[model samples]
Target chain A: MQILDRFRDPETGRALLARVSALAEQAQEKLGRRVVFMEVCGTHTVAISKAGLRSLLDGKLELRSGPGCPVCVTDYGDIDAMVAFGRLPGVTVGTFGDMVRVPGSQTSLEQEKARGADIRVFYSPADAVKWAEANPDREMVFLGVGFETTAPAIALSVAQARALGLKNYSVFLANKVVPPALHALLVDPELRLDGFILPGHVSAIIGRRAYDFIAEEYGLPSVISGFETLDILDALYNLLRQVLAGEARVENGYTRVVKEAGNLRAQALLDQFFEITDVSWRGFGVIPGSGLQWKPEYRDFDARVRFAPEVAEPRIPKGCRCGDLLKGKLTPRECKLFATACTPTHPVGPCMVSTEGACAAFYQYERRSS
Target chain B: MPTGNKSEDVILLAHGDGGRLTHELVTGLFLRHFENRLLRELTDAAAFPVGEGRMAVTTDSFVIDPPFFPGGDIGKLAVCGTVNDLAVSGAEPRYLTVAFLIEEGFPLADLDRVVASMAQACQEAGVQVVAGDTKVVGRGHLDKIFINTTGVGLIRPDVDLGYHRLAPGDLILVNGNMGDHGMAVLAAREGFGFADQVVSDCVALHRITGRLLDELGRGVRLMRDLTRGGLATSAKEIAVSAGMDIWLSESEIPIGLAVQGAAEMLGVDPLYLANEGKFLAVVAPTEVEKALTLLRADELGREARIIGEVKAGGGNVFLKTALGGTKYLDLLAGAPLPRIC
Candidate 1:
């Protein structure tokens, strides 16, 4: 009635948490086994860590961070290529912030900048076209990076860039689709996850049907959680109840935004300029057909096979815990140099560099209590 | 010598691009509103240091749509944002690590130019990038390039900053205005051009912060850079965490005329807007003058002033408006502006 203001719903959040916590406890007893739920969204990792919600959970139920952090999963070779490419003459690279802090073999984008490289962080994929139109001399590259949630926009941008006939522009796509990554995580013996807190934002586009594979094939339970604390708790509670009932299915806890089929228009937009292909994830290694590559029809914007990035697998630094951190095997504090040498200031690995990284989430939010 | 005139039709990918377009976008449409010496350096890196001490490090990843806008582009904002987070925590920014998440087919030239902007920012802030990484997703998998900067700064011995330090009667002081960054970004992203420019107030606060630390010392109780949640949310957090009441004069809160106008037009509250470069420092009333003096002497804090004070018993945040009305600034439970906002 009052537009559902949070100011008015203050107690609702508290009440929701209490109710869900009680339900979770009951479900925990009913399920009869120790259950672990993984939040696959980078935002969920941050929200969970920052709110100290993980520590608040009772012993029976555990929350794990997944590969939802796009920044944390980007490989070392790719980071070097982006920085090295940014250093190229007559080129300008536009990108998001998560890619800026990953450790490369020789230099990072920050180091490349020190050596006079031009690496710009764009808020959107379309911004590159804006820059291209304004300056007709230099070629512009949108260093596209993210999962399906952000992939559609870049697709639209590539379409727009092509339609506009801006020959001085292209995209260095680092896009990963969610379904394969989810499938990969399920098969990963290293990850013994019991349930999943699906990303609400991603679900809104990919639809609830996207996760049906996880439930039907793997028998893993899932609940789409929002960014809010109460929403997340509620999602956990639903997931726990599902497990207690011996059920495996996808349930949407965030009914406020996400729909069963997802944003149709956005899906169509993605279908226009990009196609799913097997791609590489830095920490998880290569996933067969887990990425979105430029459609050959739009090869003009394709840089790797087109421009031939000076890409090489740069050897990671010795003792960096980035690999283990991304797999959820180790916390940021578990890294050899986490606090001693690797800090938000002096990060030793890509995990520490990314704010969305499990290591960064652990260091920023969890380690204070640890 | 000009490609085209500045107009607010739409922002393209090239604006985040480091080519001639980016230069024109900044100089033509954005820089004039919030010009200063630090911003004028126009280098690819910024560098600064702490004499000697144990260091604390922090890094943040940034992704915003329509990268180039009224106040600042993603490049400048990224560098300043990383630096300020370290600065407010009483850290001397020494080194930074950056990574890139690039899309397939992205032009290499643009990457080089943005790197130059990042280098310029680092040089202005007196910090260096020691290491980094990069990765490429398929064409449809990402927006463009995502930059994550991991910064390391040395912590000073005299200052021990955490959430615990707060006492009744402590005064609250903010450098310059609120909501400028949020409003400017929003205006440009939404294509809402204004007669008067509403540029982002993004800058590295460490310069002024260092001066305050040197001048006021332990007299400063607590300090934090209010970003996405703005002053209201951060103050509420402090009040609830410290178990103290925060009372303030809404009139005393500084707001650029254009920022206030934009907020009013968009039906957004200035208190809830994000700030990239500003800070909220809790100072004892007695030390307020010294803090103000130190802040004002620095170009970044030229508009510094005392706006509020800490109180006991309330455990809530209330403000006295210019019209003498009391209003509670509550947290916006939902996303206010959606993605890139």
Candidate 2:
């Protein structure tokens, strides 16, 4: 509570915002164009919208939401595979609640659940293990879908299941890495980004070292910032200062939580159980070494290997501009299906369904302004 | 499936057959608790006199997953839900008809306890249970017990309350803390085993509303019970209905410590959680102070605060964060799911 209260101090927050505004003005004047910073984490997207940060900045600074939401970025084929696993006989599909409504090519897990498929939402991966233990007769397959912040926990669950010698527990890994996706964005010719406000939570796990490539290779400023209002302002100030000074480096604005080297044990666990593979992103397409898969030794606990369900070809919804939104190519208001055909209740794309998705954040918070 | 004393024992299929066992169970359990002249006659229906005024009638069924919870049970929720619905409509709830759907093999002692709770709730609200019915279902067909209550209240012709009466610059006030009932119910169902058990804030709000109507009259523009969709949904409904904007201060909204902690752990926003006992009252700006004073004076309204204000132009609800930023408090999309990120 003390830490949380400190970040919310009004006097400090105003001071930080004033400094951010000043830097934004300087950066824009020096460059003779708007300074655009892309926040690659979904949590940051929600926080920026929730805090109304966009409205506070004085037109000099433009923030774009990247593919931060794991559920939103998951390929349609992966979702189809998950739904098929949920429908398997004596199989209980465990998933984080964000994945329930994400539309697959044919159907979603929520629809399958309503049709008598045994699908349960668990708060943590360990909960799925406990559920598997309790119902020994049924197979429990947890849909592990997240970034570095959540991947370690899922890896730990697999290790725990192995330690407990639980035969019925498995994981359908759609886990993604953040740094590689950032690299993909940097190489993309369409996006004209000046700097990056890195995801705080994912940085806490992967550390600042993982983001050095953004500064070293691309010569783009990057700042790992927290989700608090003042933290974001401070991060924006740092990014602008770097852009104005012609410096390209990764700076840590959320040092209180994120360490330089990150959580070593979590990384080790991830390395021990899983190997990097080429995973298809919803908007960005296939990125090599961006997805996590079970190692050969741990393949027994992989749902894809154990169940071997027939996965269909991935398909995006017609007229959905989610791919453009994810790459910072378009805003939610620019998309035709933003509020009309796609909504939170009846989402046409994964972006509208996930809370952290750019479309969802825009629809929920920025629609009126747009 | 009978247990304990034969005269007062477990519910069986015979109770629904309308035979000697049914009569005994009804007389022994319900009649004893809800003793009134109309119910004593035991007719097919109880006839009640209506005064010379407009009447408000509401019916609600309670089927909480866990029939019993920390602060209150299904019986208390059923009675309070109907009574609050009528109270918000500016009516004095007077009569209620109670019905029970009991699963076979349920303990008679539990049934008696539920009936006793209902009788006490009705007494507190100054309403009488004039008619009642009971039916028993087989195990696995239904949960332990379900209660349905129909409330009738008399409304004065001059009294009117709804979104039509609302205007720009009106104030939105909620009684006490939000999300306590929803968080409490979740805690009870999941058995999160927090250091301090979260008790549901499931109580009747008629006393507070009744007093407000008496003092403020037409100054109270709109009143709604924040039941199914907490404050966010209720605020959105008012905003959409009146075609205006509602700006709530995130810092001003009162949330209990336990509820906040539990909500944080569950990855759910407290604004979307359900509340049984809380209600949002939109009042004229001039009467805001007086309404707050009146609400604060009541036992149930101790922590009441003015959460937001209604404005013209935009048809959306926004929350001003504690950090001097604004966020939209949109209508909840689906079940409040725990976040994976």
Candidate 3:
């Protein structure tokens, strides 16, 4: 098996960085200002954090983390439901690794499994189908997690499961959209972000049109970036240049996969199994139409009907400023438990549990970069 | 459905309902696979000798999808995961307690390998399999394989390092690059489907730690492996516990090229991804030169360097970029690489 789907062509990497560095120089010289860009995807958060792109920029340019993590934004209600689903009889709850340790209102999925619930983690919804086929007589419920990029896959899985007539399979849909989140961030009074680095995966699904609001309404210049080190640099360069040039437009630098209209077949498949709903976020609270729900027609595969999770008022641990950190108001180092009481060995929040969190990213790479 | 003597095919609900049938299934099938002391005892809790010294204990759950991943299986991950925990605590990993929940009909051979991997990883970490328990669930009850392992190790009297002991003028050092393990698993899973091969760097770090202990002789004030949350997390943890601030440099951090590539493909950063055989050491600034020199002398620590310093500020971790700017590094506010460690 070939281990590489892609490699860093030094030439391409250098060119991209040079282009970005050039733009940074142009923005710094032209605007006489520090250009700030917000990347709205959790994956982008990892890309930006690891590549040290933020540090490589022209001194005048700054990039900040945004409300990009789907698990970070998933509400306590949804998490509690998933956890409860973990304990259900004859119900094996399949999910992504990101959702396992999230502190639900009652118990986390990890904890529920401790009590012997059937909570399984899957890389994609397709794997869940594999599980269902392997256990024809047993019920397998896969947790539909992630943003637009992941939602389409979940939709496809639900459709496939139905097509295969797997009566024992169900879906716990927690899929969310990127545009609604961008919408909420724009109107958010607490933020003063200058521009947006739109998530490449989400952009690939909803396309650049989804972020039109950021440019048209909020006057924030947005650029779509790939996950590569140079890709982010280019996004930074593009975003900074636009701010300097006094323009707000959506630009897609990841042309390989993302399209203006995105995958229509994927859109049709998504509408087939799930519908949008006003949902809650982990740190930022609720945003209207930001979440996906299994349609009533597919209630046979809906775990919520067969199972309802018990929940409580989700409270951030005392002195744990994760909520604020999610808004990019505080960095991971600012947390009282960053390296001490809260660590990979003993984490208190989802940010620590998932390696892609901003705090973890900074610690491993940037903590010593300077 | 066939009527006469239906053999085991799919899973049964009885396997997971915590009933008598579930117990029988586990005892009848799984208990015979490994006859270790832990398996023989078969209790909810595992108790073992605790030397007359401070102990480091860690608990982690395995919830990775595919239930199994490439490079290493869940069992190997389970043992290494906890051994690394105790190892980074500066404790010679001593023992492990394992618990398993098998979905009905998981192949007996796969279970054997999972168990064997756990044993092999433990032997490499110089840890004993003290005790374990198992449960089985009926059809659709649980993932194919989920293993939770808890570890305990005794810290040597000569060594002293804890988060609370962090000082204002300590240097932060990283053993290697971050995010290889997490990205490896993610890319290996169904999502990315990249033709590129990314395997989990899931290995025990105790041997590497032993090497560092021999070389640096007590200069180590704090040791934490960059695992679930990556390096920034441990630094922030130190700052918060010691009621001090952290000052780090980004250019000094070490990262793998493949990991870098994987993160780019996934739109994720290698920093926040998880690492298995890596650690972040905080030592006295006076010893920074000695530590860096000594660390570079070793193969494991060759990629090692002094990345940052502990500061007097209260509870804020600041990063001064190579380009001369400062940004606050904070805790994971959300999921970065979930279930990675």
Candidate 4:
């Protein structure tokens, strides 16, 4: 906690911003335009907005929020399936609280729960497994949705259920990996990017070395950053410094928590019961090898197979530009539905529904910037 | 409504049927703890004397899960919530009317504990229960219990507080820490393992409000209890009401370390979390020091600080970020749900 206090100290934050401002000047002068950077994690999007960094930097640097929010990027078809599972009899839908109010084609878990469906919010997948164990007569389906940071724990739950031979416990897999989505974002010619402020937690699991391709192949400056005001400023400074020095490399700014190789044990756990597969993101349709699926031997623990919910046709709300916003092609305010039709209460898109979503962070913290 | 338990320890539907059991439960239990002249008359309405002054009446309901929490229970919250509402409006809290909705199978001992907590809080706040009602539904019809409290307070002729009295350059002062009650309740309800560390700051705020209004008078422009939507939301409402901007310093806002840590882990901002005992007092800039001194004298306001100031602008609330940036704080858009990733 003492260490965290330093990260939030106003004096330290001011010093870091001063250095970042000077480097940003040099980078912008050399580039003959704004020094654009994308923070490629939902948490970074929220942290940057909450700290009001975008308004502080203003014209010096353009920080675009990328496709990082797992909940926002979840395909509508998957949400519909989860909602369908909630309506199924003798089945209890267990999920993180974030997924409850997210709208599907017909309804949400919240509405289903209100209408006599058994939908429960659990803090962890292990708790859902425990609930399933206690109620053997009821089938429990845990919604497994997150990035690599949460995948290991969900994998552990699967491993635990398998070890215990719990017949009623299953997981609805909507887990995603980060790298392939980044690859998809980089290939878009319309979306311009010079540097990347990478997600800290995801990098802690996949390691800084995993992003070598961004520097080696794409020749873009990137820094893994923690979710703090000072940490974000330091990352922006380092990325600007790299641009000024004519270097395109991935730097580890969150070295205290992240390492070059990342957590190998967590990676092994993910590999044990899951395999990479193609997944559909809300904005980026289908990104190959970006999602996780149960291994063939662990297929029995998969909710999609156990219940076979009849998913409805995915319906996209009109005027919701979450796809464009997630791809960094448009800002939240750029969308016509942003403050008018799309809000946190009556969200038209997943971006406005999730807390880590770029649209929500902008609406909640920085919309009235001078 | 009978479950065939026939146990004395648990409540049954007959307790609310207004017959023999209902009579015993009220006369034996409620009358003993709430021994006031108005209530002892047993009339349908407990009429009380009032001075020649405007009255402030407010109603609030408490349906908190785990009716018992770290610092207080639903019963205590029921009293404090209504009392603070009237007190912040520059009124002297006097009488309260309580209504309880209990599930049939709720334990009698837990109900007694809750009632005892309410009685103690009422004594501390110097309020009496003038009228009351109790009802019990089927086991599944309601949660364990819910309490609604209505408070009536008298405002002295000289006391007038409202957003209309606010102006530019006014200072914003909070009594103490923000987000304690909301975070504590969340931790307790979810069994988040931090319940022991983050205790709720639930108590009556009438003492602090009464002192400020008495000593400072018009120097205190407005006072609002930070209940739902926490400090940020209340500040935003004040800005909108006053048609002026409010600029808050992020560094000056008081948030306890444990609540801050819990908020970070849950991915919810403490700014939008709820508070029970804390409130925002918009005061004239000249009286800011005196107000702080008075607040600090009380144990509840010991951590009080000048968090922000009113500015000349259109209706909006902004926070000067700790890192030297400006961010807008809108009314909390939705429930502050924990983040998934």
Per lDDT, the best of the predicted structures is 4
Fnat values, one per model, are: 0.01, 0.60, 0.14, 0.77
Off by over 4 Å in 2: B1-14, B103-109, B195-197
Candidate 2 second chain TM: 0.95
lDDT of 3 by residue, B163-207 (tens): 766777788888766777777777666556552566677888887
* Best-to-worst ranking by lDDT: 4, 2, 1, 3
In model 2, the Cα lDDT at residue A283 comes to: 85
TM-score-superior candidate, 2 or 4: 4
Find the 10 residues in a row with the least total lDDT in model 4 chain B: B1-10
lDDT of 4 by residue, B24-101 (tens): 889988888888999999899988889978999999999999899999999999999999999999999999999999
Candidates' TM-scores?
0.60, 0.94, 0.60, 0.98
lDDT at position B112, candidate 2: 83
lDDT of 2 by residue, B1-341 (tens): 33555644778888888999889977988899999999899999889899877999999999996778888989999999999999998899999998899988888888888989998998998899999889999876888898899999998776789888989999999998889888888877766787236888888888899899989999999899998888998898888888899999988999987787777666577888888889999999999999999999999999999999999855789888766767777777887766777
Kindly provide the TM-score of model 2 when superposed on the true structure, using C-alpha atoms. Answer: 0.94
Q: Give the DockQ-based CAPRI class for model 1.
A: incorrect
**Least well predicted 10-residue stretch by lDDT in candidate 2 chain A:** A361-370
- Report the lDDT tens digits of candidate 2 across residue range A111-226: 99989999998878998999999899999999999998888889889889999999999999999998888888889898999999999888888898988999889999999998
Error in Å for residue A30 of model 3? 6.2
**Residue range with the least summed lDDT across 10 consecutive positions in model 3 chain A:** A1-10
True contacts kept of 4: 0.77
The number of the candidate with the highest DockQ is: 4
Q: Regarding DockQ, does 1 or 2 come out ahead?
A: 2
Q: What's model 1's TM-score? A: 0.60
**Per-residue lDDT of candidate 1, residues B67-124 (tens digit):** 6666666777778998999998888776777766765555554555566677778778
